[model samples]
Target: MEIVPIDTPSLGDRSYVVHDGEVAFVVDPQRDIDRVLAVLRDRGARLTDVFETHVHNDYVTGGLALARATGAAYHVNAADPVSFERSPVKAGDLVEAGEAMRVRAVATPGHTFTHLVYLVESAGEPPAVFTGGSLLYGSVGRPDLLGSEHTRELAHAQYASANRLAAELPEETWVFPTHGFGSFCASAPSAASSSTIWRERQLNPVLTRSEQSYVDEPFDAYPAYYDHVAQLNLAGPGAPDLSFPRRAGTTELRRRIVAGEWVVDLRHRAAFAAGHVTGTLNFGIDGEFATYLGWLLPWGTPVTLLGETREQVARAQRELARIGIDRPAAAATGRPGTWTAGPISSFPTARFADLARAWQHRPVAIVDVRRDQEWRAEHVAGAVHIPLHELPGRLGEVPGGEAWVHCNSGYRSSIGASLLAAAGRRVVTVDDLFERAAPAGLDVVSRQVMA
Candidate 1:
């Protein structure tokens, strides 16, 4: 049995293609199905099955497309009915892969009513479990992700399901989960991708707690689009009709950017601040890039991506497509000619030392782009506060004039700077000034850590 991991950078998602001899099964595939097809063809394997662990709420799934293209069966949970053409899979249902491999569906419905984990049993090795959102590396799926009323019940169910798996699987059984680091499915600070049942039992916080304790833990509210994405995943979207022409060069990108198209910077926040195409918004791949982009920009806005590297461009395109942002005009090569307005000037950033000195001479407007809770605890003296999400519409509040912007890190400041610059205000970004000032008398403010 051979397992290949396919990383989708746009969504910070990883999918697996498990092949045993000439038969292949794809697990939790994002919208880009061509790559999976290519891999199957190269291995001379005929696609036999596409399995979804659950109806996902993050991005569109490609299981239906892959199944239709290859005349393979699409399998999903049987208990909770979905709209797509899928065979109902319940516990003890065994799927055969030639003579060496067999997959057994295990109902694990805490994440969703229809969630299932596939237990793969080979001829000689300990069985490996494909735990989707039900069991992540260091965390279990958040129950509140479904909604408020069902949160406690689902969390309790998830706890019970996790406990059952921990007790049933042997210590050495390999665990492969659908989500890992950077996935919002689990809360922040998750561990790496593969872990053993023994490791999770010893170290996972969720595993240590009782069902009631797990359900009682407080959590932030789920995003608005979660239900929409979940429904789309259940009834898979049709094949991507990405009719947008492939961008040829910087010249074409600039024309689109000027024509009201959104230019998404897929680079890290720090890299974006160092230098980026003028007028472009930095939606780093780490954050909810696709969802936020859809919210901030008008729908169907032709997109051009500023990826970290050439290889990442396709990943970015697929990511946007996963959220239904299909018309990507092109990927930027970080060349000067890409921007018709030339390069947008970097915001004038100043250090705390420089800001202190300047403060003595004239009033320098300091805009705190941190959250309201952050502002209430501790912030720069007399600084105006505006969260980055609200900055675009509240530009009038920022008293323009050599304005200096700062966030916990420079990411938000860079975005603030772009909004201010687009509105014709001179701005500077102070990166990580909060972290740097934490040691000093400067009171760093956060919900968890109050100065």
Candidate 2:
């Protein structure tokens, strides 16, 4: 028996392709079915089953499309209200894939109301459980994604569900989870790349803490794009069209920008800051390009991609498709100078020391655009707290002056700087690591100081 894990690092999730030599099954695939298909082809395996732990609140699922392509039976929880035809599975249902693999659907209602973990048993191999969001390596999936009304109930359920798994599963059982590897779906991040039921029992707060304590854990805002993904999943998303968009010229790029459409530059942040087409926003294709772009860009707005190469544009297109932002309206491949005849706009990129020096000389507006939890942990003294997702709507709240924008890393600050610059505010992106802020002599304060 072989289990291959495919990771989508930008979204911080993993999909599994498990096969007992000839027959293979998949769990929690992303919208790009091509990757999963390639894996199956490489193994010379035939796909027999596809399983979804829940109606995902993150990326659009590729289950329906993969099933149709490979003639595999798609298994979704019986309780989920999905439009597409699926082999509805419930608790205690046993599914067989050839003679070597036996999968049992165990209902684990924590990540969502209908989440299930698929327990796979094969002869000589250790038993492996695909614990979708119920029991993560260290923390369970956050319970607030559904809504506030369900948060409390789901939080309590999450605790019970985790305990249930720990109590029933053997110590050596391999625990595989779909969330908690930097996904917002997780209540917190897990440093472990892999874990076992024994490791989880020793380290996971969910198993060790009281039910009331687990329920009281706090959550922050998730990506705005999350509001649309679940609906798209319920409606049954098909395979993404990853073909290159129509070529866009200088005139078209200008017109789109003037019309308030998103014209995203897919270059490195440093290159973007050095020089970029006027009015184009920077979402460097090298970083978390799709996540922040999908998080900030108004849904359904036409987007035109500008990349340094055709390959960059194609890569960006594939990333966007995972989150259901299909077929970017247009694209161009070249340097910023080639995109516009007008003067290329440029911004100053700096370190925390630059910011500190400027602050000492004169008062400057510091916008801390990290999340609420990050802000509460530690922040520069006098920095205004405005999470990046909220910045587009709260522009007026920023003090009228030059704005120094930053996040934990410089990638997000570049995005924040671009938005501020586009809105006609003078902005400088602090492109250095946040760890340098204190060493650079900036007045940093902790949550205890604020309290």
Count the clashes in each prediction: 1, 0
Per-model TM-score on C-alpha atoms: 0.81, 0.99
Which candidate tops lDDT? 2
Worst 10 residues of 2 by lDDT: 209-218
Residues 1-451, candidate 2: write the lDDT tens digits: 8999999888889999999779999999999989999999999999999999998887999999999999999999888999989999999999998789999999888779888999999999899999998899898998899999999999988898999999999999999999888888999888899999999999998888889978888889899899899999998999998888999999999999999999999999899989988788999988888889999999999999999999999999999998889989999999988899899888899999999999999879999999999999999999999999998899889898889999998999999888888888888999988889999999999889889
Candidate 1 lDDT by residue in tens digits, 121-143: 88777778888888778888776
